[model samples]
Target: MVDRRVHEGEAVIERAVVDGRPVDADARLALDARYGHFTALQVRARRVRGLDLHVERLQSANRELFGAELPRPEVLGAIRAVLGDDLRDASVRVYVVAGDRPRVLATAAPPTEAPTGPWSVTPVVYQRYLAHVKQAYGFQQAHIGRQVARAGFDEALLTTEDGLISEGSITNLGAFDGERLLWPDAPMLHGITMRLMERMDVPQERRPLRAADLPRLGQVFLCNSWGLMPVGRVDDVPLRQDGKLMTRLHEHYDAVSWDPLD
Candidate 1:
């Protein structure tokens, strides 16, 4: 069963809401086991980066999965109401089940910090169905991630059947060639942060990145709605750390303006 309270440090925080109503442990678990589509975003001071992109993501997923169009305004209103007067940093998850209307779940927590150290990733050959949709069913990814953790790796990076790197279990992967950023030309979820970076005029190229290309890449990074992070290693091979590239990427990313929810 999903716990009603999320224990973070000394604070007990409410972590689930269904259709604008707070969900107890049982309800949360019931929803957790069901198939649904979702989008996760970080909210700080009542604002979010790429809020429109997140909304569009939900709308598109809802239409594709349920044959129904999601009302964006209502979802935003529900999120605002759940947040109420306290607009501190939090994690927001908007979910859409098949039978029921979309639900907005949130938890009070500090924003995710960018990775300071490098990460070690193990390649796993697996592909997600409906790769563009951010569905709630992530059992495979979670299971693979756990196995990788047990194997002394930080995360699992999914690859195509032919050994082309697709993305991380929960994040989008990008490679740096010392002069430009290259994204894998594979079927994967287009991350909001990655879209923002592209809009900010970051030089990027989308092409198939295979396992053989890892050694030649100067740097590797992972990105999602939360932030951009540096990847230190892929499998047992170490990747170069380019501080200058990370600095430039962060500058463009941080420049993206946050939209106020209220």
Candidate 2:
């Protein structure tokens, strides 16, 4: 586990022993300093929106990955214990990972100041090796971020080898076809935002999407706990940059009720 400093903070490391000889001190310290060696989780709760969805998803993910059922109470207590009242009307993250003892970090920060105009994104094909859990065990997604950043885009929409759009690197991708939003027709990771919308009976089509279909799309947008974002372009394909659809969805999403477990 890792956390932002609530007060003064110091980086800690675990040393290795080999035949009674201390393993490379310099290398271990450097690794510990850079990573802070903690689990990672991203959460957002503006006006208390989608908080339960986040916690429940985390619980389910924990059970799926660790076989140890991490309770919502434990998760929330850690957040409140560290952040106190600072969590009000802000995005909060609680990161915990295994070390000598679990390291916990609870941070409250403003959400990403999203651009008012529609943004563009490229769809990249990649698979998450671990199907569940938000542990910082790998950097595949970080590599995806670098790839998208290098391509000069706001995000990357992940897809399967056969051309089914799965999700974004950090957000969930939603396709618009003049009237409805479409998710992947096949299996894909369930996103909190996407699940919330589905539960609210928001009209969404679960179907296969093809890259060649981009030219024919009326609009595109990305959704996540943070917000619904309109996509103005996809690679070289360009479209008008109004976020009307995204706005409509966000409005509906915000009106829904969700109380985080206290």
Q: What TM value does model 2 have?
A: 0.73
Model 1's TM-score against the true structure: 0.90
| C-alpha lDDT values of all predictions | 0.74, 0.56
Q: How many residue pairs clash in all the candidates, one count each?
A: 0, 5
Model 2 lDDT tens row, 58-159: 666655545556666776665555334444444455544444433334444444333456767787888665433444434676677666766777777777
| Candidate 2: segments with Cα more than 4 A from true spot | 1-47, 100-104, 132-138, 200-202, 240-244, 258-262
The numbered model that scores best in lDDT is 1
Q: Candidate 1's error at 196, in angstroms?
A: 1.2
| Cα distance off (Å), candidate 2, residue 197 | 1.7
Root-mean-square deviation (CA) per prediction:
4.0, 8.1
* TM-scores, all models, native as reference: 0.90, 0.73
